[model samples]
Target: MDAYTQPRGKPHVHLVVGGGGLKVTDQAGAEKFGDLPWKTDLDWIRERSEVTVSRLAELFGVTRKAFYGWVEGANPRKGGSQVRIAALRAVLATLPSDLHRTAFFGLVDVNFTGDASFREVFQGPVDDASYQDRLNAKLAEINPEIESTVKRLHRASPSSRAFESEYPSA
Candidate 1:
Protein backbone atom coordinates (compact mmCIF):
# COMPACT_ATOMS: atom_id res chain seq x y z
CA MET A 1 0.00 0.00 0.00
CA ASP A 2 1.19 3.53 -0.63
CA ALA A 3 2.57 5.00 2.59
CA TYR A 4 0.52 8.16 2.43
CA THR A 5 -2.76 6.23 2.00
CA GLN A 6 -2.29 4.10 5.09
CA PRO A 7 -4.90 4.39 7.83
CA ARG A 8 -4.41 6.48 10.95
CA GLY A 9 -2.15 5.14 13.75
CA LYS A 10 -0.22 3.11 11.19
CA PRO A 11 3.41 3.99 10.67
CA HIS A 12 4.11 5.34 7.22
CA VAL A 13 7.23 6.56 5.48
CA HIS A 14 7.42 9.66 3.30
CA LEU A 15 10.40 10.09 1.04
CA VAL A 16 11.51 13.47 -0.22
CA VAL A 17 14.37 13.55 -2.69
CA GLY A 18 16.35 16.68 -3.45
CA GLY A 19 19.74 18.33 -3.04
CA GLY A 20 21.81 15.88 -5.08
CA GLY A 21 19.66 12.84 -4.35
CA LEU A 22 19.22 13.62 -0.65
CA LYS A 23 16.41 11.57 0.97
CA VAL A 24 14.20 12.37 3.98
CA THR A 25 12.18 9.72 5.74
CA ASP A 26 9.63 9.44 8.56
CA GLN A 27 10.95 6.13 9.83
CA ALA A 28 10.25 6.44 13.56
CA GLY A 29 6.85 8.04 12.94
CA ALA A 30 8.13 11.52 13.60
CA GLU A 31 7.04 13.96 10.90
CA LYS A 32 10.37 15.68 10.49
CA PHE A 33 9.95 18.46 7.97
CA GLY A 34 8.69 22.02 8.18
CA ASP A 35 6.38 20.84 10.96
CA LEU A 36 7.78 22.36 14.12
CA PRO A 37 5.91 25.60 13.53
CA TRP A 38 2.72 23.71 12.77
CA LYS A 39 2.90 22.01 16.14
CA THR A 40 3.49 25.34 17.84
CA ASP A 41 0.63 27.05 16.00
CA LEU A 42 -1.83 24.26 16.83
CA ASP A 43 -0.70 24.33 20.42
CA TRP A 44 -1.32 28.05 20.61
CA ILE A 45 -4.83 27.69 19.22
CA ARG A 46 -5.71 24.87 21.58
CA GLU A 47 -4.35 26.77 24.55
CA ARG A 48 -6.14 30.03 23.88
CA SER A 49 -9.20 29.31 21.75
CA GLU A 50 -12.31 27.15 21.78
CA VAL A 51 -11.18 25.53 18.53
CA THR A 52 -10.73 21.86 19.38
CA VAL A 53 -9.00 19.53 16.94
CA SER A 54 -12.32 18.15 15.80
CA ARG A 55 -13.76 21.59 15.19
CA LEU A 56 -10.66 22.63 13.30
CA ALA A 57 -10.80 19.55 11.15
CA GLU A 58 -14.45 20.21 10.36
CA LEU A 59 -13.81 23.85 9.62
CA PHE A 60 -10.93 23.00 7.29
CA GLY A 61 -12.83 20.06 5.75
CA VAL A 62 -10.24 17.52 6.87
CA THR A 63 -10.32 14.53 9.13
CA ARG A 64 -9.59 14.71 12.84
CA LYS A 65 -6.61 12.43 12.30
CA ALA A 66 -5.11 15.01 10.00
CA PHE A 67 -5.10 17.60 12.77
CA TYR A 68 -3.61 15.04 15.13
CA GLY A 69 -0.74 14.61 12.71
CA TRP A 70 -0.37 18.35 12.43
CA VAL A 71 -0.28 18.71 16.21
CA GLU A 72 2.30 15.93 16.31
CA GLY A 73 4.51 17.98 14.00
CA ALA A 74 3.42 16.70 10.62
CA ASN A 75 3.47 19.16 7.75
CA PRO A 76 0.20 19.47 5.87
CA ARG A 77 0.24 18.12 2.32
CA LYS A 78 -1.27 21.31 0.87
CA GLY A 79 0.00 24.86 1.13
CA GLY A 80 -3.58 26.17 1.33
CA SER A 81 -4.09 24.34 4.61
CA GLN A 82 -1.00 25.98 6.02
CA VAL A 83 -2.20 29.37 4.85
CA ARG A 84 -5.62 28.88 6.48
CA ILE A 85 -4.06 27.85 9.77
CA ALA A 86 -1.83 30.90 9.77
CA ALA A 87 -4.75 33.15 8.91
CA LEU A 88 -6.88 31.75 11.74
CA ARG A 89 -4.03 32.30 14.15
CA ALA A 90 -3.69 35.87 13.02
CA VAL A 91 -7.42 36.53 13.46
CA LEU A 92 -7.44 34.99 16.91
CA ALA A 93 -4.44 37.04 17.90
CA THR A 94 -6.57 40.16 17.74
CA LEU A 95 -8.69 39.03 20.66
CA PRO A 96 -7.67 39.07 24.30
CA SER A 97 -5.90 35.92 25.44
CA ASP A 98 -8.12 35.80 28.51
CA LEU A 99 -11.32 35.45 26.47
CA HIS A 100 -13.19 32.31 27.46
CA ARG A 101 -13.87 29.53 24.97
CA THR A 102 -17.59 30.25 24.97
CA ALA A 103 -16.88 33.92 24.44
CA PHE A 104 -14.55 33.15 21.60
CA PHE A 105 -17.22 31.16 19.81
CA GLY A 106 -19.80 33.82 20.39
CA LEU A 107 -17.51 36.56 19.14
CA VAL A 108 -16.69 34.80 15.89
CA ASP A 109 -20.22 33.62 15.21
CA VAL A 110 -21.42 37.14 14.69
CA ASN A 111 -22.00 37.95 11.00
CA PHE A 112 -20.04 41.17 10.91
CA THR A 113 -18.63 40.82 7.44
CA GLY A 114 -21.75 39.89 5.46
CA ASP A 115 -24.31 37.10 5.27
CA ALA A 116 -21.81 34.49 6.42
CA SER A 117 -20.35 33.93 9.85
CA PHE A 118 -16.69 34.55 10.52
CA ARG A 119 -16.30 30.79 10.69
CA GLU A 120 -17.65 30.45 7.16
CA VAL A 121 -15.52 33.29 5.85
CA PHE A 122 -12.41 31.63 7.27
CA GLN A 123 -13.33 28.14 6.12
CA GLY A 124 -12.86 28.89 2.42
CA PRO A 125 -10.28 30.49 0.14
CA VAL A 126 -10.57 34.27 0.14
CA ASP A 127 -8.45 37.41 0.23
CA ASP A 128 -6.97 37.02 3.72
CA ALA A 129 -5.57 40.54 3.86
CA SER A 130 -8.84 42.08 2.77
CA TYR A 131 -10.88 39.89 5.10
CA GLN A 132 -8.72 40.84 8.03
CA ASP A 133 -8.90 44.49 7.21
CA ARG A 134 -12.68 44.44 6.82
CA LEU A 135 -13.16 42.36 9.93
CA ASN A 136 -11.04 44.70 12.03
CA ALA A 137 -12.68 47.80 10.65
CA LYS A 138 -16.15 46.42 11.23
CA LEU A 139 -15.24 45.32 14.74
CA ALA A 140 -13.88 48.76 15.57
CA GLU A 141 -16.93 50.38 14.11
CA ILE A 142 -19.26 48.22 16.14
CA ASN A 143 -17.56 49.29 19.33
CA PRO A 144 -14.16 50.94 19.38
CA GLU A 145 -14.18 51.02 23.16
CA ILE A 146 -14.58 47.25 23.39
CA GLU A 147 -11.96 46.57 20.74
CA SER A 148 -9.43 48.86 22.40
CA THR A 149 -10.26 47.47 25.81
CA VAL A 150 -9.77 43.90 24.64
CA LYS A 151 -6.42 44.82 23.13
CA ARG A 152 -5.33 46.44 26.38
CA LEU A 153 -6.45 43.43 28.38
CA HIS A 154 -4.75 41.04 26.00
CA ARG A 155 -1.45 42.84 26.63
CA ALA A 156 -1.87 42.98 30.39
CA SER A 157 0.13 40.85 32.87
CA PRO A 158 -0.43 37.11 33.01
CA SER A 159 -2.30 37.46 36.26
CA SER A 160 -4.87 39.55 34.45
CA ARG A 161 -4.85 37.44 31.30
CA ALA A 162 -6.05 33.90 30.69
CA PHE A 163 -2.67 32.57 29.59
CA GLU A 164 0.82 33.16 30.91
CA SER A 165 3.30 35.18 28.90
CA GLU A 166 7.00 34.49 28.50
CA TYR A 167 9.46 36.56 30.46
CA PRO A 168 11.44 39.26 28.69
CA SER A 169 15.02 38.59 27.66
CA ALA A 170 17.62 39.58 30.19
Candidate 2:
Protein backbone atom coordinates (compact mmCIF):
# COMPACT_ATOMS: atom_id res chain seq x y z
CA MET A 1 0.00 0.00 0.00
CA ASP A 2 1.07 3.60 -0.51
CA ALA A 3 2.32 5.65 2.44
CA TYR A 4 -1.04 7.45 2.52
CA THR A 5 -2.93 4.18 2.91
CA GLN A 6 -3.14 2.31 6.20
CA PRO A 7 -2.41 -1.39 6.09
CA ARG A 8 -4.74 -3.88 7.68
CA GLY A 9 -4.42 -4.08 11.52
CA LYS A 10 -1.86 -1.26 11.49
CA PRO A 11 -2.07 2.01 13.36
CA HIS A 12 -2.52 5.11 11.20
CA VAL A 13 0.71 6.20 9.61
CA HIS A 14 1.91 9.50 8.21
CA LEU A 15 4.79 10.48 5.98
CA VAL A 16 6.78 13.65 6.61
CA VAL A 17 9.66 14.91 4.51
CA GLY A 18 12.36 16.87 6.29
CA GLY A 19 16.10 17.47 6.23
CA GLY A 20 16.57 13.80 7.18
CA GLY A 21 14.48 12.73 4.20
CA LEU A 22 11.20 10.82 4.42
CA LYS A 23 9.92 9.93 7.89
CA VAL A 24 7.11 7.57 8.75
CA THR A 25 5.28 7.94 12.04
CA ASP A 26 1.98 7.10 13.71
CA GLN A 27 -0.95 9.50 13.81
CA ALA A 28 0.03 10.72 17.29
CA GLY A 29 3.47 11.63 16.06
CA ALA A 30 2.03 13.42 13.09
CA GLU A 31 -0.15 15.53 15.36
CA LYS A 32 2.80 16.27 17.63
CA PHE A 33 4.00 18.76 15.05
CA GLY A 34 1.13 20.97 16.14
CA ASP A 35 2.38 20.73 19.70
CA LEU A 36 5.76 22.35 19.08
CA PRO A 37 6.52 25.34 21.33
CA TRP A 38 6.46 27.90 18.55
CA LYS A 39 3.46 26.25 16.94
CA THR A 40 1.46 26.77 20.09
CA ASP A 41 2.37 30.44 20.17
CA LEU A 42 1.68 30.82 16.46
CA ASP A 43 -1.68 29.12 16.78
CA TRP A 44 -2.61 31.41 19.65
CA ILE A 45 -1.59 34.47 17.69
CA ARG A 46 -3.52 33.31 14.63
CA GLU A 47 -6.67 32.54 16.61
CA ARG A 48 -6.59 35.69 18.71
CA SER A 49 -5.92 37.97 15.81
CA GLU A 50 -8.06 36.06 13.32
CA VAL A 51 -5.10 36.12 10.98
CA THR A 52 -4.41 34.03 7.88
CA VAL A 53 -1.08 32.62 6.76
CA SER A 54 -0.82 35.29 4.07
CA ARG A 55 -1.40 38.06 6.61
CA LEU A 56 0.97 36.50 9.15
CA ALA A 57 3.65 36.11 6.48
CA GLU A 58 3.30 39.75 5.59
CA LEU A 59 3.52 40.74 9.24
CA PHE A 60 6.68 38.72 9.84
CA GLY A 61 8.20 39.75 6.49
CA VAL A 62 8.33 36.13 5.41
CA THR A 63 7.13 34.39 2.29
CA ARG A 64 3.81 32.48 2.37
CA LYS A 65 5.68 29.27 1.51
CA ALA A 66 7.89 29.62 4.58
CA PHE A 67 4.98 30.51 6.81
CA TYR A 68 2.90 27.51 5.77
CA GLY A 69 5.93 25.26 6.03
CA TRP A 70 6.46 26.40 9.59
CA VAL A 71 2.81 25.65 10.31
CA GLU A 72 3.37 22.16 8.93
CA GLY A 73 6.29 21.38 11.29
CA ALA A 74 9.24 22.97 9.52
CA ASN A 75 11.70 24.97 11.65
CA PRO A 76 10.10 28.24 12.74
CA ARG A 77 13.47 29.98 12.67
CA LYS A 78 13.56 29.25 8.97
CA GLY A 79 10.26 31.09 8.61
CA GLY A 80 11.43 34.21 10.46
CA SER A 81 14.62 35.45 12.03
CA GLN A 82 15.11 35.79 15.79
CA VAL A 83 14.56 39.53 15.66
CA ARG A 84 11.35 39.12 13.68
CA ILE A 85 10.07 36.48 16.11
CA ALA A 86 10.75 38.72 19.08
CA ALA A 87 9.03 41.66 17.43
CA LEU A 88 5.99 39.49 16.62
CA ARG A 89 5.76 38.33 20.24
CA ALA A 90 5.95 41.88 21.51
CA VAL A 91 3.24 43.07 19.12
CA LEU A 92 0.95 40.15 19.99
CA ALA A 93 1.36 40.91 23.68
CA THR A 94 0.35 44.52 23.19
CA LEU A 95 -2.94 43.64 21.49
CA PRO A 96 -5.83 44.00 23.90
CA SER A 97 -8.27 41.07 23.80
CA ASP A 98 -11.11 43.48 24.36
CA LEU A 99 -10.55 45.23 21.05
CA HIS A 100 -13.27 44.24 18.61
CA ARG A 101 -12.28 43.10 15.12
CA THR A 102 -14.58 45.49 13.27
CA ALA A 103 -13.36 48.40 15.32
CA PHE A 104 -9.75 47.42 14.80
CA PHE A 105 -10.25 47.23 11.01
CA GLY A 106 -11.96 50.59 10.92
CA LEU A 107 -9.26 52.25 12.99
CA VAL A 108 -6.39 50.76 11.01
CA ASP A 109 -7.97 51.68 7.72
CA VAL A 110 -8.38 55.32 8.67
CA ASN A 111 -5.13 56.00 10.51
CA PHE A 112 -2.53 53.99 8.57
CA THR A 113 -1.35 53.54 4.99
CA GLY A 114 -0.05 50.65 2.85
CA ASP A 115 -1.56 47.34 3.88
CA ALA A 116 -3.33 49.25 6.60
CA SER A 117 -4.83 46.42 8.58
CA PHE A 118 -4.34 45.18 12.12
CA ARG A 119 -1.43 43.24 10.64
CA GLU A 120 0.36 46.54 10.05
CA VAL A 121 0.74 46.93 13.79
CA PHE A 122 2.83 43.77 13.99
CA GLN A 123 4.29 43.23 10.49
CA GLY A 124 7.61 44.77 9.58
CA PRO A 125 9.87 45.91 6.75
CA VAL A 126 9.61 49.38 8.13
CA ASP A 127 12.05 50.99 10.55
CA ASP A 128 11.75 50.02 14.23
CA ALA A 129 10.81 53.53 15.30
CA SER A 130 7.94 53.70 12.80
CA TYR A 131 6.74 50.20 13.66
CA GLN A 132 6.80 50.94 17.38
CA ASP A 133 5.06 54.25 16.94
CA ARG A 134 2.25 52.53 15.01
CA LEU A 135 1.96 49.80 17.62
CA ASN A 136 1.85 52.39 20.41
CA ALA A 137 -0.82 54.33 18.58
CA LYS A 138 -2.99 51.21 18.21
CA LEU A 139 -2.50 50.30 21.87
CA ALA A 140 -3.38 53.85 22.86
CA GLU A 141 -6.76 53.51 21.21
CA ILE A 142 -7.54 50.19 22.89
CA ASN A 143 -6.14 51.04 26.31
CA PRO A 144 -4.42 54.33 27.02
CA GLU A 145 -3.22 53.14 30.42
CA ILE A 146 -1.41 50.23 28.79
CA GLU A 147 0.11 52.55 26.23
CA SER A 148 1.24 54.90 29.02
CA THR A 149 2.70 52.02 31.00
CA VAL A 150 4.53 50.75 27.96
CA LYS A 151 6.00 54.17 27.30
CA ARG A 152 6.96 54.53 30.95
CA LEU A 153 8.73 51.21 30.89
CA HIS A 154 10.43 52.04 27.62
CA ARG A 155 11.73 55.28 29.10
CA ALA A 156 12.85 53.67 32.37
CA SER A 157 16.44 52.62 32.97
CA PRO A 158 16.98 48.88 32.97
CA SER A 159 18.14 49.00 36.56
CA SER A 160 14.94 50.81 37.52
CA ARG A 161 12.67 48.15 36.09
CA ALA A 162 10.87 45.78 38.50
CA PHE A 163 12.06 42.60 36.75
CA GLU A 164 15.67 43.53 37.43
CA SER A 165 15.06 43.82 41.18
CA GLU A 166 12.30 41.24 41.63
CA TYR A 167 14.60 38.27 41.93
CA PRO A 168 17.61 38.02 44.16
CA SER A 169 20.73 36.26 42.92
CA ALA A 170 21.22 32.82 44.35
The prediction achieving the highest TM-score against the true structure is: 1
Per-residue lDDT tens digits of candidate 2, residues 58-97? 6566788777666656665542344455555566665655
Residue-level lDDT of model 1, residues 1-170, one tens digit each, is: 78897787755776654322334577663444544666677788788875667777876667887777677656777547776677667666776554533355555556654676656666645545575665445444434444555666567836533333455446
lDDT of 1: 0.61
lDDT score at residue 14, model 1, on the 0-100 scale: 66
Ten residues in sequence with the least summed lDDT for candidate 2: 98-107
Candidate 2: residue 3 lDDT (0-100):
72
Count clashing residue pairs in model 1: 0
Query: With candidate 2 superimposed using the best TM-score fit, by how many Å does residue 140's alpha carbon deviate from the native?
Result: 5.3
- Local error of candidate 2 at 143, Å? 6.2
What overall lDDT goes with each candidate model? 0.61, 0.58
TM-score of every candidate: 0.54, 0.43
